[model samples]
Target: MKEAAKGLVPASSSVNEGAAPLVERLIAAATELRIGVERLENGVTVLDGGIAVCGSVAAGIAIGEICMGGLGRVRLTTSGGAGAAEGGWPTWLEVASAQPVLACLASQYAGWSLSASKEEGGGKKFFSLGSGPARALAAREALFDELRYRDHAASGVLVLEVDRMPPPVVVDKVLRDCELAPEQLTLILTPTSSLAGSTQVVARVLEVALHKAHELGFPLADVIDGDARAPLPAPSPDAGVAMGRTNDAILYGGQVHLTVAGGDEAARDLARRLPSSNSRDYGRSFADVFRDYDYDFYRIDPALFAPAEVWVSSLESGRTWHAGGIDMALLRRLWLDEA
Candidate 1:
């Protein structure tokens, strides 16, 4: 595998640079997108998708694209609902990327952890896992080292799934790590209970697949192209429920297709192990699993965090392999109620 990986070309594009223009366009169309915009005291710009405004589906799709560092496309589409009632969902978020590794792992993965506690002089307890193109500039996570990638850009954009503004301390940390002036930073806040949040989270279907494949020890550089989609559930007002719905959307209803440069055997192995059904905790709704685990997210099986279905095509052998199947019954149970 290491020998084959040498043939892979290094990624030369800057994710932060690629996303800067998209960030400008998103802020430029804030009013039309039905989102709120504000500037903090420190001169850092903030865009609110659901906190102070009623965010729309359009804004979510746009944010999803930005989250992928402009390397991926996100769109709203209708599901065919085959072999199930209403096909479990009428709406879905479809995502595609030619640069799957960089788009999903280097950009979209929420691998950076930021937090503030009252004891540490923070105004209140605050925590969020940072995502989007800005992570490439910070390069704080070890994953960046493994990928041997970093970004150099004058501007940066970050997406946070939180209901409130980040503490100024956390913002300061971002400025220091990315070496960006306050004016050069933009923070986007999307709460899970909002339309925008649900859309953007479900849009991570492809990213989740890439992340799982990486975790399973597959050679990421071999993954050349990818596409995926998952059912979009109504955002719940309850925080826990909202989180579960987003996760369950991928665990039960998401599907992904990956194109790789590896041999047929390697591609078949990746396909076999890249689905949620392979985990012991696969039979229940995510909400139920969370409750059973006493709401401690880490206590649950990490293997359960994958798309329900997958397809892998090996360019080397001109063959394709598939594994897993979507569970529409479980999706309908979680998404719909017969009132």
Candidate 2:
């Protein structure tokens, strides 16, 4: 029953400033709804005393809708560095629709910082870019020219930074006829540690920029971390596993060979039960279906000291199915489309 904080706020007026006010406002808003905010220095905020909503952005939106537009207690986990890199692109485009004329400052200088801000004025949200003075000036001009030719409202600015000179400066100068301000800007800094280590340095700068954007209320839906990559757990020993294309005349190889008999009623039954939508819609006898089917066999490369053979028998014969290495249950699941 708690209400979520509304609106995004700038992270810092200056680089060294803490996010105390932002956190305080968020806490106050949530507290009104009987929710607690747990702030962590590692850039994580936990919402408690309500339903714990945890998942991707899509999941969060669904949860929000279910709560009747209410924001529930949630844990905002970083999805690695995905948010830091590609986040906010859509938001920038959306804002550009309104304020057609805006400057976008991206830094190619070393040791520069970047930030974003959102303000409500004239019944619309105005986003601003903050960065070093040089990048800010250039971004202001570029925005003006973009607005003249475009039909969208001049929303705000997009700041992008790199190790080299940014394109905004040239763009702004080209449209010098229009005057732009230093305040309506977003600054993105791209710094380089060294010419040899440019790539690594650029990557780090990008990550930092993304984090800063998220802190500034850019709604970075998620942040995926690259360092958390890990392998999937092995399957259970008792679980039957088979990997093959669905509803296709195919051959499987392992400790045992399962030769699907063409006309056998049991084979037909098994084929009928194959895990596939096609089988349900277009039921066909296995014999008539795979008339020219050729059985291909392969050995379980490592050789699991077990008896293996291909079972080619007729379904009408009622022959007792015998296979040394075949898991009957798994075969049933695979053919029945129950898996």
Candidate 3:
């Protein structure tokens, strides 16, 4: 492996090198379950990488949680609830890590929106959010600037929430941007419509909460520990529908408990402003709001992306504030009322 560039510490010296180990764990777990894996001649490892995985039962919950920012541990589980109203869906996934701030905030939410510009072989455009440990390498987004988080690893794993396997052109672009050789990179693909895809997306309850807090201008550094849950919606016939259900699970059924350093007053403000209900466009399925804005995600209210309920504990003051609760009426509406 190349030495760290001048003035930079070796990857060994930095604490940020969590992606490599977690990728190994994810691979082992998936392989034990007979989940599909592939290694291309270019040394790129692909997990659930193609249409062959479509409709195939996969280790969705396990595979999904493993891709988070150097996960401390992940639990892929199902619900105690019975019936279709576990609505929109039944599986629930959760993660707990010692480095909750890094794992949930910097790694999992997948803030990077990678698009092929005309110069990068625009003949056919490709798009996927650059996430997982590789984002620490890419550090392309504005959030990275504020978080002051970055990593340099001999090997890296990245998770892409896209249907198609990344073409070599795209893969090359990522490797170049991350400054890693193909052999050192592992790529996992999960489409929104796939069983595993929806499972993982729903598993992002904690990430959604953190993202919401970040959007509300809450200092994320204050967040100490987080645990969250949302109904795992079933994969739908349409990719768009599956996406909608997973999103609604978070928007209407997801719940979060955040332990933070802030005092009660600050926690109350966060609690009051941090649920999907706080948004003006609160009562609709994500697909509806998305389509109403012509499928332009940016057009939707950013606040609507939060969990349905939030509980904040002020570690500094020993006070806890709970705001919002399951919006089952809205969830049921989104579940059965899908147009």
Candidate 4:
């Protein structure tokens, strides 16, 4: 019988033993795909952390789990999957008990929001903000300070969602920031266009809502659980097109439900403010905005990065406030354009 690579985390573990750090699980996934790990020189390497470079539906599930920082459970579900197999299965993720703020908002989704870009050694040097628990160890972003959370560990694992691999200098900075040797660091690479990549990106629906809540002064600590769904688009040959379609999944079709304990008014206001549609950059596909900005992410409006709709149910008051709705017309337009 074919089995997962040895030493990988079993599907079952003692709950009393404490959950493993998300980065460790990510590395296990990398080890499972060691043949798919592409080693680069200069003490830096590029590796397939989850599914192989060209991944599978199961791999997409694993990737979604990684995106939740492993605090959340990601699974393939048939919800809204009627005619949904446009080449990929549907997925859902849920999180509770762990640090959702640190796991998803700071460590996972918020890391690469505005990454560093530079040129060194006479060649272009670019580093997407590293994701996963390693970002907590690096504490490289203002979001880390705002959250007062950081991870201290011997190993620094980073997940980068980019079409290009990191150059040596980019690798060096992470090593220094996390105070780890080159050999102690691992980078999991997933481009925005691949099947795994798209699944993982749509997987951020919950994080998007949480981050926006934080931005709106909602007490994120009160958010006890979260789950979300977004349509899975088919893989595309063009990375840009794939990226656009995936963002559309979130901006147009994604729906996030968060359970929290803030007052109904606060929850309502936060929910009211938390959708991509609230941004002035709404109505147009993300591809259109990317093209208008010449593909520079920073140049685009930051407010536009959020789920299409958010539903917040207050645990204390037992009240739910919902805002926004799916943009099916816009979603279909993007899909037909891609087709």
The models' CA-based lDDT, in order, is: 0.88, 0.23, 0.72, 0.64
Whole-structure CA lDDT of model 4: 0.64
Over 4 Å off in model 1, which ranges? 1-9, 80-86, 120-123
- Model 2 Cα lDDT, one tens digit per residue, 1-339: 001112121112111111123223434555443433443333233333222311122222112111110111212223312211333111100000010001111221122223222222333332222232233223343421422222121112222222222333332431231233333222222121211111212112222222322223332221111111100111111111211211111111111112222335544343222222222212332222333233221222111111122222232343424332222233233334423
lDDT string for model 4 (134-222, tens) is 67667778876666566665565567876666666667777788787777676767776676677667777767777777877776556
Write down the lDDT that model 1 would get: 0.88
Task: Report per-prediction Cα RMSD to one decimal.
Answer: 2.1, 25.0, 5.8, 7.8
The candidate scoring highest on lDDT is: 1
- Residue by residue across 258-300, what tens digits does model 3's lDDT show? 8877557778999999988888888878898999999998889
Model 3 segments more than 4 A misplaced: 1-16, 29-34, 54-58, 78-90, 117-123, 333-339
- Model 3 quality (TM-score): 0.86
Q: Residue 153, candidate 3: how far off, in angstroms? A: 1.5
For candidate 1, lDDT tens digit of each residue in 1-339? 445456332567888887888888988999998999999888899999999999988888988988888889998888534523445678888899988888889999998999988864355788999999889899999999889888888899999999998887899999999999999999999998999998899999999999999899998879888999888889998988999999999998889999988678889999999999999999898999999999898999999999999999987787999999888888787779877
Least well predicted 10-residue stretch by lDDT in candidate 2 = 92-101
Indicate whether candidate 2 or candidate 4 has the larger lDDT.
4
